[model samples]
Target chain A: MTRIVFLGWLKEMAGCAERQVELPSLATPEELIAFVAGDNQSLAEQLAEPSIRMIINKSVLAGKTLPDTIEEVAFMPPLSGG
Target chain B: MIKVQSDIFDPGAELNNFMQGRTDMGAVVSFTGHVRGQNDISALELEHYAEYTETEIGKIEIQAQRRWPGIHTHIIHRYGKMKPGEPIVFVAVCSAHRQDSFRAATFLMDSLKTRAPFWKKEISGDKGVWIEPKASDYAAEKQWTNKV
Candidate 1:
């Protein structure tokens, strides 16, 4: 099971701030994005935006590998604070 | 120190508290950011990740400390809804010299603008627009590297 978090406009598009998904197999960040988007075309497009950031387990997701014990994953739009 | 909260804070009072009994530190620099009312913006809402916002800011604070040793820092960032002209964030740094205090304050603010996880939405009437960091902000943060 993996916890997915959506921030900014993505939360409105996803209709929820966070959700849980049980992956059929260990999936990379890209595959996880594809799976999460599923049939939601709008979500898929937003997720594909280059400015969007992916953070896994509280850190920016780096490299391509997704471990089996992965926990939380967050999708965030460009940050504008301070 | 780092604080992310919804309550409105008085930057002057916070600075006073931070400066209390700190005569040994020769210089203290502080910055306060306010919500802008451009394009008739009525309110601004700041969204943040409850779990990672402070930790990320803490990381930047640590970096600033490492970059300029013997400096003390305090950061207060407000989240949730705020009206135009209301204070949104406050950063204060103290050091033995003017250069370190000034540079550390600027570095902390620049990092907060680019590296922090807070997103802002400008509310105008019934419409709200999410804002992205400007190219200048990124460029500002980039200037803190070894080349400088």
Candidate 2:
């Protein structure tokens, strides 16, 4: 099981801040997001927006391989804080 | 030192506290971020990952240290609601030389502005909008990409 965390508006749209998902070993981050977006079309569209940012293991990631042992991944909107 | 709290803090006091017990330090640079009042922005609501905010700031601090040796970095950011003109963030860097401290403080601020998990929402009257990073912020952070 892996956990995906959401923040700010994404959290509000998703209705929860964090959730655990069990997926096939071959599942990709995109697939994970799709799974999370599940039956919510608006959520799926928002997740697909280009302005969103992804962080895996505390580092900002664009597109990268996800290690099997990865524990948590975060999805965020563009940061605005100083 | 890194902190993510909701209480109001005086940037001057925090700077003095950070400078306390230090005689070898010759240069100290501090930067404070305030909630801008333009465009009818009355307040700001900051949200962050309760577990990862400090750790993420710590990662930036470590990167700053690697970029500038012998530099001491301290970052404090407030979360939750804040009124206009209130302090939102404070970053101070102390080093033996002026150049290192100045560059390190700027580096820390630039990194934190983009890399930190904190998200800001500007409340203008009854309307609220999620703030977006400006092009200048990306340009500022890009200067450090060629290093390490």
Candidate 3:
């Protein structure tokens, strides 16, 4: 199971905080983003944002693999909290 | 120490407790972030990536420690709903000298402004808006020159 979590305005846009999807095996963050968006073009477009960051199971990943051990993937906008 | 909680805390007592039993410290710098009541803000809803908030904060803390050796750090960030005037975040650093502690505290806060995975949704009247990172904040963090 791959849980894709949303935050901030993205959460408001998604209408929920997270969505769980079953993956047969390992998947890239990009792949997971598309899978979670599915047919929602708006969500898909939002996920494409250059500012969007990917975190897999609590580690902020950059050009990194989402291995089979990964259980959650978070799509985050540029953080503003301090 | 990193505590990401919803409860309010007394900065004074917390500061005392953090420095307790540490006699090698000569200077301590603490910063408290409170919810602003400006613009008629009824409350500030803090949302965070539960799986990542603490880990990211811990990473940043460790980075600061590595950058400024011998500096001790404590970070407390609140999540969920909070009204105006309530404390939202706290950062304290203790070191043998003011310079090291000051730089470490500022570095921790500066990195946290943009590095941490927490966001604020400002609610006023009948509307709510997710706050974005200010350009000034990015600039401030940039002045650090050293990326965590």
Candidate 4:
């Protein structure tokens, strides 16, 4: 189980801020994207864009590496100023 | 002092409160950000996560204090509906000299715009649009990574 977090309009669109997803061991980020896409079409469409950022444990992850534990993962839209 | 409020702020009173009991400081620099009436197409509606926004701003203030030792810092960000000419945010820094206070205040506002978790919705003629961070803001924030 991995904790996935969403923010801003994405959270409103998804209807929740956090969720727990149970996935097979050693699943890549691509696989995670597929899993999310299957569950939430709006999220899937947003994630399909290249500009969106994926962060794991506060560090930006660019490669495909699955976490061994259910750590917190954040899916953030492009940030805006106040 | 750090504050996130929906009401308008009196810059004069706020500065006095922040400067009280600070005889050691010689210079104070402050920046007040205002809501622009035109958001490319029309007006903008600002929204934020109350708890998270305050926490993030607190962290920024702490970081500023650490960077400039013995300096006083204050950050105030207003949430919800704000009109043009209204102050949206305030960042003030005080130090022994003008250079340190000036630079720190600028850095705080620049970083806050990029790292802070605030969203804006622009309302135009019969349409509304959400504003996203510009490439320039990202570039500005990236420059600080090496300094930190």
Model 1 lDDT tens row, A1-82: 7899999879999999999988667567778788888899889888978888888889887778886676888998988999
Residue-wise C-alpha lDDT for candidate 3, range B1-148, written one tens digit per residue: 9999988888889899999999999999999999999998999998888767888899889989999889999999999989988999999999999998888899889989988888988999879988989999999889888553
- lDDT at A6 for candidate 4? 76
Best by lDDT: 1
What is the per-candidate TM-score for chain B? 0.97, 0.96, 0.96, 0.90
* Candidate 1 local lDDT, B44-129, one digit each (tens): 99999888999999999999999999999999999999999999999999999999999999999999999889999999999999
TM per candidate comes to 0.96, 0.88, 0.92, 0.77
Best candidate, DockQ: 1
Task: Report the number of the highest-TM-score candidate.
Answer: 1
TM-score of chain A of 2: 0.79
User: Which of 2 and 4 is the better model by DockQ?
Assistant: 2
By TM-score, the candidates rank as 1, 3, 2, 4
lDDT score, candidate 2, position B1? 89
Steric clash pairs (candidate 3): none
lDDT of 2 by residue, B55-100 (tens): 8899899999988988888899999999989999999999998999
The window of 10 residues in a row where model 1 chain B has the poorest summed lDDT is: B139-148
Native contacts recovered by candidate 2, as a share? 0.84
Docking quality class, candidate 1: high
Error of 4 at B119 (Å): 1.6
lDDT of 3 by residue, A13-76 (tens): 7778888878655467667767778888898899888898777776778775776686887878
Off by over 4 Å in 1: none
Error of 4 at A1 (Å): 10
Q: lDDT of all predictions, in order shown?
A: 0.91, 0.86, 0.86, 0.77
